[model samples]
Target: MDFLLEIIMTPAILACLKIAVIILLFAMPLGTLLTLMERKWSAMIQDRVGPNRANIGKFTGNGLLHIAADGLKSIFKEDTIPKGANGFLYLIAPFFGLIAAVAIFAIIPIAGPIGNFTFQVTDVNPGLLFIFAITSLNVYGAVLAGTSSNSKFALLGGTRASAQMISYEVFMGLALMGIFMVYGTTRVSGIVNGQNEYWFGNLVPMWGIFTQPLGFILFFTALVAETKRAPFDAPEGESEIVAGYFLEYSGMRWSAFMLAEYVSLVGVAALMTTLFFGGYHVPWLHLWENAPQWIVTILQILKFTFFTVVFCWFQIQLRWTVPKFRFDQTMGLGWKKLLPLSLVNIIVTALVILTLA
Candidate 1:
């Protein structure tokens, strides 16, 4: 019993557990709020009331409480397992979806520092590869869910999803090559630290977005495809495919897929912030450098959270603004356009950096 307890208490095991719960708890709600924001923003864009109806009885309109209402609605709904579906695989699908979504946050830097420890879950040497590896697992969930459903629409959705993910993953990783080249390290925390020094002593706050705008564009486009989101969301084409891979899932099972989608959105946005936007660095923040460490830490956390919320809002707005693409068009954009462009950008950026050096 003592040996077993020792194994359980190992640093690796405890770290894994902490990271797992942190990713799930934080990522899940961020996604849910993104869903609500999508509705609210879409309403604003179209000059219509979005979801004010989802409220507590007396108030009739509570902005944040709508999320609570949505959760309860999903929980109380009747869970239905289809007659022809593979019961075991059907149950497994949503869990895989959720797990894939939650796993990607392991390497993201959320705050500057918490005491002597970094707020990053893991300061991995191969951090960038870890992110791509975990995100690549998303395809399995979509494919398995679709194939197990035993429905024609589900199969089509799954196939489209798999193809789209594979095509985009190539360029998604390629987009970061410029970042790795410029920073000379694959460690995310190192990249953040590298940006701390100014270019001309005016607090330039050198971010990846400014140095490699094309890479940023490529990353953003590829991420949109990866998340199965608008302008690239051909796999789950609601109008044409009728809800894609999750056509047959109902109740809590279906809710899991929905949750996974939103979580993925948040994860991608957080990544974009960390990789291209200097993580939690606020412009002109050096003046407060000599301030109390605790105060500085709180300011950094606030900055990170603020940008997180802003990006979340941006994604919601983009969803409402953009329309889904044709399947062929989506694939063409990834393979024919984004991929080649990203490769060229990597080469150009490296050459420019070397010449400047």
Candidate 2:
């Protein structure tokens, strides 16, 4: 019993618990909150009031109550399985998406190390590759949902989704090759540390954005497409496909899909923070190296959270601002345009590195 207690008190176990709590309390809730914010944001863009009707007594919480209301509604709502649907796959599909979305956080360092505990769940050496591997499984969720539904529209959406995700994924990987070449390591912590320096004798940050501007653009565009936002959301073209791969899902299952989307949105934002925006490193934070460790930790956490929220807002704005693309247009842009550009970016990055070396 003492040994077991000691094991439970170990740093590894504590880190795991911290990670789980952060994901559940912070990441998941933030994602759901974004759903409300998205509505309000779009309404503001369109010059309309949003979501103020959800209230308790006189306190509406300015539509903040909608998040809880939505959750309770989903819980009580009837879950319907299609008449001819594959019951097993239908039930498990949402979990695939939710898991994939949440798993990416494991490699993201939230606020550097605090004593024996790091903010990240795991410090995998091949951090970027691990992200790609896990995110690749997300396609399975859409495919399974579509195929199991036994609906033509669902299948079409699934097919388009898989193709789109695969296409953009290639560009996304290639675009980041420039960063890997510049940083010389695939570990996210290594990359973040690399960005902590200043360039031009303290005049400018040596951030990934400075070193890989073109790569940032390319990677961000590919990421937005990967998340299936507007202008690239042909897979779920609601105008044509009704509700796409999730047409048959209802209640909590449907909620799970929505949650996965928002959660994935947050995950992408965090990745963007880690890869290009300097992770938790604030500008000139090195000047405060002698500050208390707790103060530094809090500052880093706030910085990371701010950047993540900004990126999430940017994504929401992009969704409402752009019109959906046609299927052919989407395919052409991914394959003919982004893919070629990513390759060129990599080539240029390599040559520059060789010249400097």
Candidate 3:
């Protein structure tokens, strides 16, 4: 019993718990609220009321309570598994979905140094590889959920998902190669540190977005595809595929898949924040060289917060602005367009770096 306690309560375990809680607390509510916000934003864009009907007993029209109501409503709804579905796989699909979504958080650099310590989890040297590896896991969840359902629509969705993920991942990794070459490091924290160097004069800190604009654009596009959202969301097309992979799931299981999608949204936002937007580094961070630890911590948090909000807003805007692409168009854009461009971008970046040196 004592041994079990010691193992379970280790510093690593505690750290994992804190990270999980931080991610979950931010992710779950943010996702649910964003669902409402999307609707509200869409309504304002088109001129209509959205989700104002949800309320507590007395507190009517309070947008805050709608999140709780919608969640509870989803919780108590019917739990149904299709008659022909593989019961065990069907049961596990949502778990896989949520797991893939949440796992990416492990590699994201949330903030700058807190005194001598960094405001992240393990800052593994192979952080770029880690992102690629975990992102590959996401397709499995989609494929399994679709295949195990024994439904035609689900199968089509799964096929699209698998192909789409594979096609886009190529460019996603290649796009990062530019940044990797620029920094000569795979660690995300290290990449941010590389950006700490000043360019030109005292102004213009060297961010990857400025140095590798083409790579950043390709990375951002591929990330959009990888998240299986927006213009790339043909798999979940209600007009044609009928809710895609989750067609066989209902109740909490369905909710898990929904939650996973939003978590993935947040994960992509965080990744974009870390890779391109400078993680938690405020402009002229080096200028605060002598600031106290608490002050530095606050600054880091504020930076992260600003970027987080911006990323969320950008995602919401994307959802509204971009129309869904046809399946073939998606494949073409990924392979014929982005993939080759990313490779060329890499070659050009490498040659420039070599020539300049």
Candidate 4:
């Protein structure tokens, strides 16, 4: 019994619990809130009222109640499987997307060390590679959903999704090669720590953005495409393919797809934070090296949260402001434009690093 208790109380077990709680309580709710925000933001852009109907005794909470109403509606709605659909894959595909999106957060550090614990799920060494591998699995969710639905539109959406994701992923990986080469390590936390350094008598940040400006642009663009958002959203082009790969889905299963999209939005923001914007490092934060650890930790968390929220808003803004690219235009940009530019960025970064060394 003592041995059992000890095992249950181990640090690894506690960390696992912490991670699970963070995902459920923090990440999940944030994704849901983002869905609401997307509606509100788009409404603001298009001059329309957004989600003001759901209420209790004239207390709608300024559209916030819609989130709860949406959740309840999905839960109570009919979950339909098409007569010709492969029921097994249709049921499981949403889980694949959600899991793939949420898993990326495991390796992402939210803040620096606090006592004997760190604010992350696990500190994997090949952190960037791990991210790429897990995110690539998300394509399978789209592919499976399309194939299993047994509809031409769904299949076309899935095929486009797979092709588009595969194309951008090549550049996404190459876009970060400059970061890995400059930082000299693939560990996420290590990259964050490296960004804490100062340059020119503590005037400028040694952040990824400073060293790899072009790379940041490429990575951010590729990331937006990877998340299947506006401008790069040809795969799910409503005008062309109806609702795309998720056309047959309804109820909670459909909600699962939306949740996955928003979660991937958050994950991409976090990755951008960790890679380019200095993670949890406050600008010139090292000046207060002797500050209390807990205070510093809280400040770091706040900074990271602020940046993530801003990026989320930015993505939502893009969705409303920009027009979706034509499928051919999307393919051409990814393959002919972004791909070549990323390759050039890598070579240029290498030469700069070698010369400076």
TM-score, structure 3 vs. true: 0.93
Q: On residues 1-357, what C-alpha lDDT tens digit does candidate 3 reach at each position? A: 999877756868856765776576766667666767777877777678766776567776646667777778888999887878888887887888788888887767666765544567677889989989988999888898999899999988888889999999998999999999998999988998887777887588788888899998899888888878888997787779998887778878888888888788888878887788777777786775688767777887778767876887788788888899999999999999998999999999999999999
**Candidate 2 residue spans exceeding 4 A from truth:** 1-12
Clashing pairs in 3: none
| Cα lDDT computed for each candidate against the true fold | 0.82, 0.89, 0.82, 0.90
Better of 1 and 2 by TM-score: 2
Clashes of each: 0, 0, 0, 0
Q: Which ten residues in a row have the lowest lDDT in candidate 1?
A: 54-63
- Candidate 4 regions exceeding 4 Å error are 1-9
User: TM-score for each prediction?
Assistant: 0.92, 0.97, 0.93, 0.96
Q: Give the TM-score of candidate 4.
A: 0.96
Two-way lDDT contest, 1 vs 4, winner: 4
For candidate 4, which ten residues in a row score worst on lDDT?
18-27
Q: In candidate 2, list every pair of residues with a backbone clash.
A: none
Give the residue spans of candidate 3 off by over 4 A: 1-10
Question: Model 1, range 136-225, lDDT digits (tens) per residue?
Answer: 999998999899998899999999999999999999999999999988899988887766656777647788888778998899888888
